[model samples]
Target chain A: MNFDNMRFSKEHEWVEFEKSSEVVTIGITDFAAGELGDIVFVELPEVGREVKNKEPVGAIEAVKTVADLFAPLSGVVKEVNTQLEDNPGLVNQSPYKEGWFLRLQMTDRSELDELMSHDDYSRITGTE
Target chain B: MSEPKKTPLYDVHQSLGGKMVEFAGFLMPVAYGSIIDEHNAVRERVGVFDVSHMGQFVVTGTDAREFVNRMITNDCSKLLPGNLQYTVMCREDGTVVDDLLVYVISEDRIILVVNAANIEKDYEHLTSRKRKNVEVSDVSEEYALVAVQGPRTREVIAACPFFGQVADRLQKLPYYNGITFYHRGAEVLVSRTGYTGELGFEVFVPAELAVALWDQIVVAGEDCGLAVIGLGARDTLRFEAAYCLYGHELDDHTSPLEAGLSWVVKLKKPSFCGAEALRKEKAKGSKRVLIGLAVSGRNIARQGYTVLRDGREVGRVTSGAFAPTLHKSLCMALVDRACSAGDGQFAVWVRDKEVPAKPTSLPFYKSRAK
Candidate 1:
């Protein structure tokens, strides 16, 4: 996937911002998806819930283990991908796009500036 | 602790994109691809598991049959030659040492397949309790075990060219039975036994030819949708079948009676290790019992999760998972017998929240193994 427009978090989440808007889309990166393995269920934060930066907002249930889904940015959970409720496999199949976890209305846009660029993210993931 | 051991197929697994993890003092594959995919492959078509990490022992002597019959909880006399029986060895106090498969080769010879983690413990236990006429030898490193399991296991086994004429014998082999076949001038034992609740077969081949046999089976089962399974799926499959894993359900502190393995405890046998304790427990009834839980939702009630009744801690989850075949979250818990009374509703502490759960029948997914 072309991740040029996305900002990556150290926690392996990706955030895409809407041009000139405070709204941003967040999802786990491909590396995280591969590590999670066969996601059976996704517990997304409820809409309108306040989320803190780097705090666990929900959980991702895999076949053998469970992983916490951390909030990449501080915001109100504007929307959650309801599609994940019934089909969590999408997170593994399309980690970057359709697998997006939540739409956040950012309370602090400065958090996005602290996120890593595509190159930095790749370096951390050792994909570079 | 000593460094973990590696199996003959370690390199092959790495080449196949397997995710390796340390399990029971061995570097084993946890998943080749997706664990769910591997799990479904076994339930629907066929799947192969490298169970080489499991420990194997050979017992032979004039009194081997009599000796073994007195060691385990199952009535080994009922197991005819070429048959296998699932049983547990316990301490004199009735606490489990390990759960194993006893393969009856003959009246005076037997093969004991034990858990990988309990190799040394089981070996020592058997030898310490041995009689002068019986001999016990650990042959764990001599064989590579592969389990081909699922509804399509028969077709896949028949397609393997390496089996040659033995494939025909394996095809007709009844469940819980094994056959000794000659391959490359060595004795190869194929048994119709598996932990998965499915029609399956476990083949024990010489260690040196493990990779070759694995390759042949892969090629042979290419069109049958056979995937290379790993320990992750193996545990899930066994959990769905309600099979007791050594450290999970059956442990050093757990009794077979409390583990819901009373069927294997042949108290009728005059004397055996743990016979007295088991008989006493059977008479007084067990303090706690293993029960299946139909967890309400996605949040898995993992091992160590507290099972509560009316906000009181009753027991803990032994094993839990999202069963692929049943498409629901299920768990096996050892709860106080009082929890079974009145309404079936209970709660499982999944982290901070108490997820609603209720007692359910075991073998969560009815096994098709028979």
Candidate 2:
């Protein structure tokens, strides 16, 4: 639940660095999953698919509704969460942990600076 | 945000942390906890739904049956007191306006419950075509409707100290039967029919007493596992049960025959709203039929998903969802006449994704249902 080291978006996405220099992990914000009930399916982008910042790279569907997962930064999709196809409720149970949507091959790592910080995203979503 | 409209049971759902949604202009609880949890509660034990948004109208006086027989497609002349039947209000062209339940409470009085979105429209239609001997009026705002559905509904009612009689009526009553009965001294009309594909009852009571009734029922049934359901679970439960939703399956553009509900229509009648039209359509078989499609891929075929044959668009997906009961991608699609696509020979173009699907029979999870 702590978003201290992350950068967030108004669309309810978060990006964080994976210990390695070029790797980035992406997931939908808690607000998105809560607004959408139990997640039923997630369509992740193919590996090596280049995506622009804020452009949709994948989708998430819940029992009653559906939402788009946007690319937090312009990057090539290094990995997509395949496990979500069978158990999409992971987003509802643990959207931040096991529910991470995709991993990106970051093109411009500095784009993270433009995203809202933890405190800023919390205020924007009004979940503060 | 604008002020969220509240139902008669608004406080009860919110107090239990319900997620609210605007459906047919009313702020209604779509779910209390998890949708699947609430859905399963209805199938296994009992679940209560605040269906006040659905409109109710009263038709009374000397010629109630005559008025209904002329307006709706079903024959009402044979309906005596304490009888109920599922009927459809249709346009002159035989296209369904809205499917509803007609309750003949007495020789001179009857109550008609309609879909929430078609309240104003159905009311206006009834009033404009007023019968000389029958007085028709919309009494939706003055009433609140509640539904207690599932197999163990009777057990839950017995827990209510004042509901001994209600429990008995619900158990002995046959399907499609209704009675203007009493509940804890307050008179109500309980009908033995529901959308959940189970033994259930729909209660119509005074709007002012709605909240008290919901709380009383909840407290009485809590130990028996009666959950408070919202629209979210309602849609899923109905879909899993293969029940047709008005907007999705049957619309102004879709005919009753095409929607596979012609059983409710009586063409034997001398004359009703759409008898002639339906008779002609019957001679010339319907162009399309509503069939169930269970998909294989994760890309769900939603409301407007295109159905493809030979990779070309054939028909459209009317309503689709992640069916909780079957735990698979399921949809209801209207395809070309007598779609010959064998068991596993169909696909849906879901947002540029060609997802694998097959034409499966409805009620995807019949074995587990109540």
Candidate 3:
């Protein structure tokens, strides 16, 4: 829940880097989940698929609408949350923890600098 | 084009954290929290929906019944007072104008409940087709409507203190029937009908008393698991029941017979608005038929998605959703009659990808109301 270490995207995604590794975990923010209503299914990208920053690599299917999951940073998909295959509600229930979408090996760590902090994201979404 | 109108329950929805959206010229709630939760609550227990945005019109005069019978596709002559009929009004060419519920009150009075988006158009259609001895009045602003649905719907209503003696009679009120009583000197009508495939009631109360009525129902259903639903859940519930949404399934270009609403289109009726055109179409046979499609993919086959038979496009999806109750991706589409005959290899174009689909029978979910 600490925003000090998290980087948020204008598209409502959040990214957290590992302590010393180039790998960064990605997921949509709670505000995004709330906006999408009840998530029923999620389409995950295959591991090792190279993704570009701001490019859609996967999709999240809610009860009424579908949203593209955009990559917050350029990287190769290293791991995906397989648990979301059967229980997509986790994205709404725990947007920052277990609902994490995928971990990517960062191609450009500097991309995180361009992302917004929790404060900036809160302001953009008017969640504060 | 102008500022969206707000219903009497607008403030109540805001306080409940409802996600408001502009729909049919009114600012209404799309969901309070989760649509699936609201949908399940209606299927398993009870749920309430604020549908005040829907339009209501009253027809009165000596020739009201006869005028109504000539306007709608259904035989209103068979309906007794206090009966309700799901019917459609069409143009002279057999194209749909709007599908509405006809509330037959008496030989000289009737009520027409129409969809919100089509209020102005329906009013114009009715007035243009108006006959002698009949008068049409738009009373939409005078009433606020709420739908309470589920297996436990009756229990929730019976517990409401304001209902008084009417509660006892409502229990015996058969399906498609309604009862009217005076509440605070204002006429209130409660009908045993709903869009969801469950035992439900649609209450038309005075606009001024709408907030109080909604509050009372919420309090009464506190112990029995009642969720305050919004438009999101309302669509899914009705889609599960295969109810034809006005814009989705029924439109100005589609005939009632092709929409699989032949049962309600009484061609035997001597003369109605579209009776002649419908009779001819029925004899010639409809070229298109509405069919259900079960998508075998994670992605939803959304509206306007192309339906494919082999490699050729056959039809377009009308309405689709990940059915919360069924837990499957399903959609309803109007396809060529040849493609509707038997279950065959079908697919839906979800963007550029072709997802496998199967031609299934209409109504992916069965009705539990009866």
Candidate 4:
């Protein structure tokens, strides 16, 4: 996955869109993963479930604390990452690739413009 | 509104990039890097912890022993010099005041180490009960404690220049015993006791010399893979070992019997604070008891979460975490005595769902001799 092409949410989630499909992949940013420490469990929204932007869809449990995983954009859940059931540490190891949370069938593709670009996200995370 | 207090090793923790957090009104390191790495380091090798945030009090006088015996639940009359005993202080109603370690320096002198958050309250309690011939003083500010624990602890201590001569003594020091030795014209008290279920030692030194002592031990244990641990791993380690933390497993409203600390309470003692209440509770049996719960899933159960049996709330989790050593999600909870009986199953409310769980024994982990 090209993180450069990803759009970011203020809640630290990122969405990547395909050129020929309305389906987009979502995951937490590397900075968010690092801050949360070791990831032990990831609760993903079920496929076919519709979610609204900024809504609480699932949860992530770390060794220290638990946090809510928010929906980055309104859409229908296409596919949930079943691999995370046995290997939640994948989020810590590869947040953008194998650790991608779920695929969403976009309701409105124009919402991508409201999300921050990679550079803007980096600036907000103080990584730039 | 006031700045949090700092330990003597504050600068050292910052230099090592420790993640600092406020605990018990003191700024302490939660972890230097990965808490799991630090936890594993202690299980496999040796690790040092700067636990200077814990409080200490010195009791000395002709009536020291007699006075102390009246304040705690443990039978300290059998405690000889150069020995340590784990005990709990209680209020008149038999609820816990604080759990502490009593180091018998001599017949007339003893040192009590208590939780940092309970320092002032414990001091006040001790002073208020002062008798004609006894003197109780809060010496917490004058001391710093460092714990070196794991299988390789003895080798690491022997490798140090200051402790080499006493290596054999340290190796021979039985568990729950201590000795005083001179280090650079200062008296350092070393004890064979630790919270982790490992062969370990705790050293008490003058606060001013804490930095030097920490640095030397770090260098000596470098070859043994001794990592500096923090409070994050400390809680996990102790929880796995089934050690009761003051605020979590114990509180003013919790009794020692309910906390599974009956071994430390002595009913045969002639007279002690809360003796009558504890005796009555012992005869009547406690209404609630502490029990271990092992969750069946990866979702961890945290403190304050409710435990249920047949869809009814039975208890609340006091301490819970993913056990790094056991590779299981476990917790200690205080529940209705009836729910903890027989072969009943439990479920812990994690987030919006109730995850299945079952009662288990205390101490999810134990160290195997090498």
TM-score for chain A, candidates 1 onward in order? 0.96, 0.92, 0.97, 0.96
Q: Which stretches of candidate 2 lie over 4 Å from their true place?
A: A18-20, B1-5, B183-185, B338-344, B365-370
- Tens digits of lDDT, candidate 3, B115-210: 999999999999999988999999999999999999988889989986877989998899999999999899899999999988999999999999
Model 4, B262-287: lDDT tens digits are: 99999899989889999999999998
Distance (Å) between predicted and true CA of B167, model 1?
Answer: 2.5
- The sequence of per-residue lDDT tens digits that candidate 2 reaches over residues B1-370 is 4564566777777888887788887889888878988888888889999999888889998988788888888888898888898888888898988989899999888999899888878988888887588898888888888998887777766776545665776668777888776665667887887888777878888887888878878988888889999898898888877778899988888888888788888888888887888999889988887888888866678887888766766788888888776678899887776554454367898876788777788666563333
- Report the candidate with higher DockQ, 3 versus 4: 3
- First chain of model 3: TM-score? 0.97
DockQ of each: 0.85, 0.72, 0.82, 0.74
Order of candidate numbers by DockQ, starting with the best: 1, 3, 4, 2
Which docking class does model 3 fall in?
high
Q: List runs of model 3 lying over 4 Å from the truth.
A: B339-343
User: Between 1 and 2, whose lDDT is larger?
Assistant: 1
Error of 2 at B166 (Å): 3.5
For candidate 4, the docking band is medium
Backbone clash numbers for all candidates listed: 0, 0, 0, 0
